[model samples]
Target: MTVRMFMGDARVDAIAPDDRGLAYGESLFETMRIHRGDIPWWDAHMARLTHGTQRLAMPLPDATRMYAEAMALLDGADGVLKLQLTRGGGVRGYAANSDAAPFWMLSMHPLPNRIDSLDTIWCEITLASQPRLAGLKHGNRLEQILAANEVRAANADEGLMCDGAGRVIAATSANFFALIDGHWQTPVLDACGVAGVMREWVLAQVDAHVTSLKPSDVECADAVFLCNAVRGILPVQRLGARAWPRTHPEIRALQAALAQSHPGFEPLLEAS
Candidate 1:
């Protein structure tokens, strides 16, 4: 991993110990797929970031300068780029310090390991309903962390999480989609869950529904997939004892379509 830090626009050596992001999780982030030093979904990520900053009352970084630095950090490498924006340092309290500058970091990480198909488990950790924060990629992710731990303990690549009402929300780290009766359906993010960039792209590409999902819906679906900006589209081969075909036709078709539209996901199409 490689990182560069900035406070507002100037370079920074380290995050202050009292940074709001560390003190109270007062921050947001966007993880993007970098292909040959360029981000194909830059616009989508930026839009989400802008929306998040507005909601949280945080300052938006200078995009042109950020991109230039990101490319320099990527150095023509194909990998993951994580952009984190914090509300800057605080003075040991929850009250807003309106004068503080925004603190941001850009880091590059190696590509995620390729999994032919994901083996998943249904996590017992339920997401809390917080509509105000729903659909935003905020820094506080204790729920996902706990759920991912459950997945690891179960020896599954990912875990399906649900809200307290038992409505399926999403996977530990990605958006969830299932094929039901020839239609693509994903859980609604009105209550909780991050609305991923790839999910937005997929929704635009296919006729899909954003609605409530039951566990039975997932179990009985024709096929399932997990998506994130970093990992284009990941087919789910097994969830608990239920198994889906390794060669799901819709999965392959979607992957191909995504690759055609985004150069970053092109390699995934051939492999899928």
Candidate 2:
């Protein structure tokens, strides 16, 4: 549980007690995979973080300093790096003044053991319809927390969550994709869910289509998978009582494609 705190350009021992991020989850975060002491998709992660800061009207810490600190923390280690940026300490209220300096933190954590396959469940708690915070990795994750609780209760690897209108959004902590009609299809995230970095890469590699999807659409697909920057790509082997064979070519091809693009996934792809 080692952590390296960053408040603007200066490192700190602890966050201010009145920080808005702790008070009301007013923060944004990026969870990335470290490979050979580098983040393969660093540009994408930074771009999304910048977009989120602008969209939320929050100030950003110095990017160069943050990158240097992150690299120092990695120290040639391969694992997960989590960066969190908050609106800093602010007065207690809903309306945030525009003069607050941002507080950020960078932490390193061990990667979860790689699972060859995943068993996901359709969560009962639906994602709330909030187009304003749709694609940002904001810290207001009570929904994901609740959905993950459902996953824990079901003893499943992950949980698939749908929007209030029954449109499949994403997994609790990752993006969802299915092989439908011979093409990869993922739910459009205009209404909810965080658009994951690895999901973006997979979409670009496969020319994946973004469309409205239903639970039945996923259930009847040729293959389904969940992806995140930390875990690369995970093929879904079982969803509730439904099962997918390990020999699905589309899934295999995706693994190959990912390995070709990123060396971190090569070992998983070879084993697959």
Candidate 3:
């Protein structure tokens, strides 16, 4: 995979070995989809990135230069773009010095093959409550990595994670939503989970509610689905012993709504 490294105003071929982000996961990243050479939600992604940098007290590289480099790297191809920003090189401790220059990287990868439906599993790796980093998409992703491993073991497409108290949080790499009693409901990310970009769009496009949901609530819902910026929206066909009918109206409506908003998801609606 080809990667372009950025440190302050200069670009390099590779990341420094002693970077803090590499040592302690002290970084933030955003995975975005490029369609016809344009990143539809670039502004939103950058807004979240800036928010994360501010919260972490980390410096941000030049946005204009970063955008230029990213676009140049895209080269008019439609694919996934990942931006990783680290706290640069640091002397071996948790005590942040605040003076270190930030190191950032931009890499482009092939998009995952499109699937009509996703089979999800309820993971056993419970999310610990951490309000300080609740909504930001930080690099401390061991929980998600573990949950995804469980998903692979279960032969499922993705894993649904819950808090230590058993309240549903999110999918391993996406946010979850379910239809219950004709209403769209999703778990609140107040105490855990990443607030996904596609999730924010869905909340605006549909009449969705954020509430604390139990595992049984998801299992007994009228229909269930997951959403992420990269893959758009996905319908869940099965979760554990429970299976949902493919033609659930709520699911179809959500897919249609997504298609109307983003042409990239139109293929998904057709496949569904």
Candidate 4:
């Protein structure tokens, strides 16, 4: 992976030992899909990052400079780009230094292998309801890390997470969606989960409802899928004993629509 580190506007070599992002997890990050050296959803990612900065009261890095540097690092190659913004170095306590320059970094990596379907398991780890940090991609991710480990141990491709109340929230790394009673419904993330860019686009494209769901609702749905910025849409084939043997026509249609809007996902459709 190729990476560039920055402190406010100036380039930097390494992260400071006392960086608040490292010490206290005061950071936000966005992972984007790059197609032919261009980030089609760059604006959307930045908008989410901006929202995170506002919530955390951290300074945002210059968008213009970030874009230029990201493109330069890509060098016309297709890959994944990650942008991370931290509160920078701080004093040895929980108190933040508002005047300190923010630390940020941009890194480029090879795209992950394409996946057409998912074999998911119900994760035992229940997401804590933190309304203030619910939708932001903040750096504190112990829950996801543990859930991902569970998925790996279970030999599942993904894991579905719920809140303490047993309300289905999302997948370990993607947003969850279900088609029930002829309507598409996704779990509301007002109190948890990352508000994924692809989820927003899909909601705008279809007459989908953002509401609460339960495990039984997902198991009994006509169809189920997972979505994120990198992987446009992926049908869920199995969740433990329940299996969706056939791909729903609506899922194919949405995949076609996503390919039309974002050429980066066209390859995923072909692979599917």
Candidate 5:
């Protein structure tokens, strides 16, 4: 794993232990798909990161310098790049140091093994409703952590989560969508869930409805799929007792379209 750490604009070997990100989860992160030392959706990822920083009042890093470091870390490899931005180090208290420099890090990870289809479950861990934090990729991810643990223990590929009102929100690490009546419907992220970068691209590519959805809606839908920046498009073959076609024709078309649009997903398209 390649890593580059920084404090504001200066390079560093490691982060301070008293960093707010470590103490209070005061941070934001983005996991990008790197293709041949480049991030095709760099602009989109930076947009979200900027949004989160503004919302949280955290100092933003220089985007140009960050991009250079990201490319340096990737070093022409096809993998995943994770950027974590924190509120910098401070004393042992909740009160933030207004003068503290922002702390950030970039780490490179290999992409997980690709599977053509997925089997998932509805997890018991429900997402907490926090509209202010909704749609941001913050460091506080205990909800997703618990849900992912359940999926791992069940030997499933992933798990779908719901908000307190029982409205389907998203999967543990990805945004979910269902095909119903020849239309694509995804859960609205106004109440919870991170708005994934890949989900943004897909919505831009197709006419999708952002609406409130229930588990029954997913079960009754014609097809279901999950998308994230790391995994372009994933066909969900089974969720609980309900099952879908391993290769839904519509899903294949979507995957092909994504592969054509994103170079990182070309391998997934070839597997189909």
Candidate 6:
């Protein structure tokens, strides 16, 4: 992994001990796919990051400078890049530090191994319906952490989560999509769940309906898949006792379309 820390535009040694992001989870982040030292979906990621900062009332780092630094760190590698933006250091309370300079960091990591299919489980953890924080990649993630731990303990590749009302939302780290009645459907994120960049792409490609889904609806679907920017599209092989084919024709088509649109996902089609 390669990392570079920054405060505003100046290089920094480390995060401050009093950083609000460290102390109070007042931050936002975007994880991107790097292809030949460049992020294919950089604009979409930045748009989401900007939305997050606006919602949290936090300052965002300059995008052009941040891009330059990230490219410098990547150095023509095909990998993963994570950009984290924080509220910077603050005093000992929850009040906003209006004068603090925002702190940000860019880190590069090796791409994960290609996933042909996923074995998933229905997690017991449920997401709270906090409309204010919904659909933003905010820093508070205890719910996701616990859900991921459940999946790891069960030896599953991913875990499906739901809101308190029993409406299936998404996976621990990716968005969920189900094919039923010859149409693609995904859960509405107006209440909870991150509006993943890959999910948005898939929605545009398929014209998928943003609707509510129950576990029964998912288990009865003809096909199921999960998606994120890093791993592309992943077919669901098994969830609990219900099982489907490791690859579906519709999923393959979507992957092919993604490959055509983004160079980073082109390799995933070959792996599939």
TM-score versus the correct structure, for each prediction:
0.96, 0.96, 0.96, 0.97, 0.97, 0.97
Candidate 3 per-residue C-alpha lDDT over 106-128 given as tens digits, one digit per residue, 9 for 90 to 100: 99998889997889889999999
Once fitted onto the true fold, the runs of candidate 2 whose alpha carbons sit more than 4 angstroms away are 267-272
Worst 10 residues of 3 by lDDT: 263-272
* Model 6 lDDT tens row, 55-99: 889999999999889888887879999999999988998999567
Whichever of 1 and 5 has more lDDT, that candidate is 5
Model 4: lDDT of residue 48: 93
Task: Name the lDDT of candidate 1.
Answer: 0.89
Residue-level lDDT of model 4, residues 153-239, one tens digit each, is 999999999999999999999997899999999999989999999998999999998999999999999999999998889999999
How accurate locally, in lDDT, is each candidate?
A: 0.89, 0.87, 0.88, 0.92, 0.91, 0.91
- Per-residue lDDT for 33 in model 3? 90
Query: Pairs clashing in candidate 5?
Result: none
> What is the Å distance of residue 225 in model 1 from its true position?
0.8
Residue range 10-30, candidate 2, lDDT tens digits: 788998998999998989999
Model 2 lDDT at residue 116: 77
Candidate 1 segments exceeding 4 Å error = 267-272
The TM-score obtained by model 6 is: 0.97
For residue 190, model 6's alpha carbon misses the true position, in angstroms, by 1.0
Candidate 6: count the clashes: 0
Per-residue lDDT tens digits for candidate 1, residues 1-272, read: 69999998899999999899999999999999888878878889999999999987788889898888777787887999999999998787788766788999999889888666789999999999999999999999999999989998998899999999999999989998999999999999998999999899899888999899999999999999999998888899899889986648888888888888776675343343
Candidate 5 lowest-lDDT run of ten: 263-272
